[model samples]
Target: MFTGIVEEIGTVEAVEPGTDANGVVTDARLRVRGPLVTSDARPGDSIAVSGVCLTVTDLPGDGTFTADVMPETLRRTALGELGTGGRVNLERALAVGGRYGGHVVQGHVDGVGTVLSRTPGPRWDEVEIGLDPALARYVAEKGSITVSGVSLTVTRVGDDSFGVSLIPTTLAVTTLGSLAPGARVNLEVDVLAKYTERLLATAGSAGTAR
Candidate 1:
């Protein structure tokens, strides 16, 4: 589990495509350079790379670690588009008794969203991100959403999009500041909303059976 707080901006060192016996690419291995995150890292540690939870497969002792990305993960998130020299938001797994800076984040990219527009303010930037209509029900105004591994509050919510305010600190620290219109980002809606929906559905089904 994670808290959706980005600890560092890591660089992709290499991406090795994994192929099958038939030479069909099925997965990818990514080596990312994050000095802070890799300092105490060991093989099998879970790290959130751009909102995607990946297990550390190897540590090369060079401030870099490797993880494998499955084909389904590539199809569902924007990590597949990442290449060498790409910047990615990185976060180590939440430690026991750690400060909960952000909301509960499973590091599971629910879906991919596109940056619709950016409205700059004197103090911050209000960014509108296009969302899938099916996922709209899970999002609410003033609720929390994780975008590219950074947790942010939804300032406004629409049927097909939502807005978030990025402060100067966020703009300076994470990769979100460089996002352009039409840029793809991994989005994870509030997990609490999903859990509530599931519980309500289960209760309704039980009432129906009675």
Candidate 2:
């Protein structure tokens, strides 16, 4: 589990694809440079890479680590789109007794969202993300949403989009600082809301059956 808190902005050193003799992609490996997050890293540790939870397969030292990316993960999230020198938000698994700064984040990207617009303010920037109508119901004004591993509050919500205000610190310390219109981001809505929705649906089904 994670808290949607970004610990560092890591650089993708390499993305290697394991191809078979037939030139079919069998698997993929990613090398990321993260000084702070890799300080105590080891193999088998869980890390959130741009809101996708990946297991550490190798720690090659020099403040770098490698993780294996599955094909399904690639199809579901944006990790497959990364290239060498790309920037990614990195965070270690939320440890017991650690500070709970952000909202509950499983590091499971539910879907991809597109940056619709960005409005720069005197002290902050408001970013609007084009949402999938199915996921928009879980998001509310002032609620929390995890975008590419950074936890932020939803400032506004529409039928097909939502907005978040980014302070100077957020803009400087994470990949969101460089986000522009039409950028793709991994989005994880509140897990609690999803659970509630499921329970309500189950209850309604039961009532109808009776």
TM-score, candidate 2, is 0.96
Model 2, position 19, has a per-residue lDDT of 83
The lDDT, on a scale of 0 to 1, for candidate 1 is 0.95
Predicted structure with the largest TM-score when compared to the true one: 1
Encode model 2's per-residue lDDT on 50-95: one tens digit a residue. 9999999988789999999998888778888899999999999998
Alpha-carbon TM-score of each model against the true structure: 0.98, 0.96
lDDT for each residue of candidate 1 in 74-125, tens digit (9 for 90 to 100): 9899999999999999999999999999999998889999999998999889
Determine which window of 10 residues in candidate 2 has minimal summed lDDT: 71-80
CA lDDT scores, all candidates in order? 0.95, 0.93
Q: What's the TM for model 1?
A: 0.98
| Residue pairs whose backbone atoms clash in candidate 1 | none
- How far residue 136's Cα lies from its native spot in candidate 2, in Å, is 1.3
